[model samples]
Target: MNVFVSEVRQLIDRHLPHYVQSLQAEPRLKEAMCYSLEAGGKRVRPLLLMAVLEAYGKPISIGLEAACAIEMVHTYSLIHDDLPAMDDDDYRRGQLTNHKMYDEATAILAGDALLTHSFGLIADAETTEMTAEIKVALISIFSKAIGAPGMVGGQLADMLAEKKSLTVDELAHIHRRKTGDLLTFSIVAGAYIAGVNKEDRLCLEQFGQELGLVFQIKDDILDVESDSETLGKPVGSDETNYKSTYPGLLGLDGAKKMLSYHHEQAKGYLHKLGLSDTILGEIADYLVERLH
Candidate 1:
């Protein structure tokens, strides 16, 4: 798993920035895009996509474009999430957020550029295996995953729920779309590229749902348990923002249990698909147990 992660990280680092630099856009805009994308994230979303390909015995090259596209979208979300109107954070991944490195307006535009370009990457991807039909299918589901019916809508719901009371179920509802939708896309996209049957794809989506819960719950736990040096961002930001979190709504111990429950549930779905011994399962454990 470590080798797999390192390889994917290297691939993204090698290609994503150069792709942006090759663009015929304003230089500053290009720089801003590269700046955020260069941050050394765990690359969880992209890894999930590629892992699905590996599980089906497909080469990573076949899904590299889609993997990179999802990373672009994920980076854009983080950039926007740290803006003044949002989380208002100054640091991310132990460095300055886009707004702090450049400015608010530039940060906003950088995010937009990444988001818009992501679809184009998938739609007109150079992947030899990606037919026009496959490209459209990828784009349709990709758009829906991050658009209004997914991440965007979830963001709005999160904003609305802030400072107000929320139950565990409500919090789950918001995050399922906000965080889970993109994850579901990652898994489903891989299955699509692998040409898996619909039955298997549905099982992966179920696993993605449970994994999403684990991701959010662990994030909530880290917000309380981790510090600035370790997390690369300020701790206690959830409480500072008065946003409902798993740890905040349920006690820390309760959140840990929820995290474990979902972690195990996620593995169960993989078991159903007989992927428990594969990289897919390993990544699930990584996401659940990751400290930062």
Candidate 2:
């Protein structure tokens, strides 16, 4: 856990409760929903969104709702991904997964609610000081990133690929959609809100996609090497399902080398942007170093 991620987790903890509490539905069900939201996962995407905003000399407060919206989408994906029809996991973030803690139907509803509610959160964001065009751009970017051509399509490909052999390029494509798309939005949303020019925003998009590919490779490596207790989910599940992964296709040593290559590429982009912020560097380092 890096210090910056720790700080971001604290920010989420402080802000998310008020937002959830205000949702005010069936108190028990809503409480369960909040439980899943506040269960202390790594708030990685949200932190990246905020950090990118900060890197552009913008206040994090300007993107707080957007940041939290990203988390909501991430959380919803995890909950559904853990469903019996999906990954069928029993644990997450060192706790019972939503389906295991609550019932499957409740978990389904929770995920659905989170996804829809995320849009509402973004819509209700206090952008009074921002121009209308910037706000509209933020909304468009977030929607497209999480919609049909992005995360949803990626998830479908991932499901279809289970127990199947895929070329390195195919695997990369699936990962880009499944994981990279939302991450791209994370960077783009921040930059769009901060009025970054189109060319600069494109650079950030490239950075996000490259960084996302590295992140997924590292995640696959962790699935091979990390313990179930440490991972809070079944380890070696990729092997169990006969799925292709970096380690499966490239071998552990080869995968490590490939990860190094992606990391260098991403670092090169960040350097071109003249970023001195150690947070972005640390994120890159964390993505590569966490597999062990």
Candidate 3:
């Protein structure tokens, strides 16, 4: 891993689990929320936020609250996504899925708690420099990213696309919302916190779009080529669920090509933003090249 990524990951890992602990919520609920938060996935969303902050020469502390909020939303999505009514996965990050670790009801409540508290975390952020305007903007973008028009809407579309064929554009639409929007939010959030100009923020949004494609396409490739142990989740589950994927739609080689194309596009956007030599560049490479 890059030294910068390692540092940010460590910062997130150390603090993420504790946020839910101090909530005035039920003990079991907090335990379940903490259980999934600590499961230790890539932490990619938060990393993107902080990395973009660093790229803009802003303090990482300026974005930490929003980073955690983004992560909590992500983790909640995963927990709910693993429910029996959804993907029905037994494991994630090499541990039992939340529903399996505790129970379905507890898992549901835990996700809800995390999702609701995330906004509060940002609103009440202890960052002395953050203003009400920034908090409100973050909350607005965030709700849209993970809510009806974004992740949830995309998820519904994904489920409906199962066992059916879709064109490249159609598949992109689903992944754009289900996966891309939140990733875009992560980068854009940093730009907002960094007080970047409109043109620069636009550059980051474009960069994030390409990176999101790289991530989802690589994920599709991994499902076919990697193992359950390597992924820390079941392999070939996409096929089993009859979901449309870049690999399924374009074939493995074709998917690789798409991934490569997006990776390059992201680099172009970074160059456009004058961030080609920064940690954002490293993160872009890591996202597409990662094994899991």
Candidate 4:
């Protein structure tokens, strides 16, 4: 699993700079885009996509383009999320956010470039070895996952829910769209590329959903327990923003319990897919245990 993670991280690191450099027409925009893309991260979304491909006996090359595409979308979301009108965060991954390092307009334009360029990358003939039909399907999935009914809707709900009391179900609804949809797409996109059996694909989708919940719950717990230096962002920002969180609704102990429950559920889905002892299994564990 360590080797797999290392390989994917290296693959992304080597290629991401080239992608940013392609935007030479607007040097400042390219700089802002590259700044966040180059910033160190776990690259969990792309890793999950490639890992699913590897596990299904598909060549990792087949999914690398899609992985990059998804990472672009994820990074774009972070840039916008940190804007003054949004999360208003000053730092990300221990460095000034794009909006902070550059200007707000530059940051917004950089994000827009990343989001649009991702689709172009996916559609480019040189990007992947998949068929035209497969590429189209992947693009459709990618668009919908990040579009109104998915990540965008969730973000809108999250923003609207601020300073308002929410039921546990309502909070879950917000996250299921906001975070879960994209994570689910990451795994399922690989499955589609690999042409995995429908049953296994469904299992992976379930695992992604469970893993997303575990991720958000762990994040909330970390915000309470971790320091800013360790987290690379401010702690208690959720409180400051009056956003709904698992910990806030469930209490620290209840949130921890929920995390454990989802961890088990994610593992169970992997077991159902006959991947209980694979790197995907280890990833499930790692997601729950990771502090940042």
lDDT per residue (tens digit) for residues 58-102 in model 2: 777888888888888888888998899988888887788998998
Candidate 3 per-residue lDDT, tens place, 41-119, comes to 7889988998888888888987888888889999999999999998888888899999999999999999999899999
How many pairs of residues collide in each model? 0, 0, 0, 0
Q: Pairing residues by index, what is the TM-score of model 4? A: 0.96
RMSD of 1: 1.0
Q: Give the CA lDDT, 0 to 100, for residue 106 in model 4.
A: 95
Candidate 3 lDDT for residue 131? 89
What TM-score would each prediction reach against the true structure? Answer: 0.97, 0.94, 0.97, 0.96
Candidate 2 lDDT: 0.83
For model 3, what is the error of residue 196's alpha carbon versus the real structure, in angstroms, after optimal superposition? 0.6
Worst 10 residues of 1 by lDDT: 120-129
What lDDT does each candidate get?
Answer: 0.90, 0.83, 0.90, 0.87
Question: In candidate 2, which residue pairs get closer than 3 Å at backbone N, Cα or C atoms, i.e. clash?
Answer: none
Q: How do the residues 141-177 of candidate 1 rate in per-residue lDDT, one tens digit apiece?
A: 9999999999989988998898998999999999999
Better of 2 and 3 by TM-score: 3
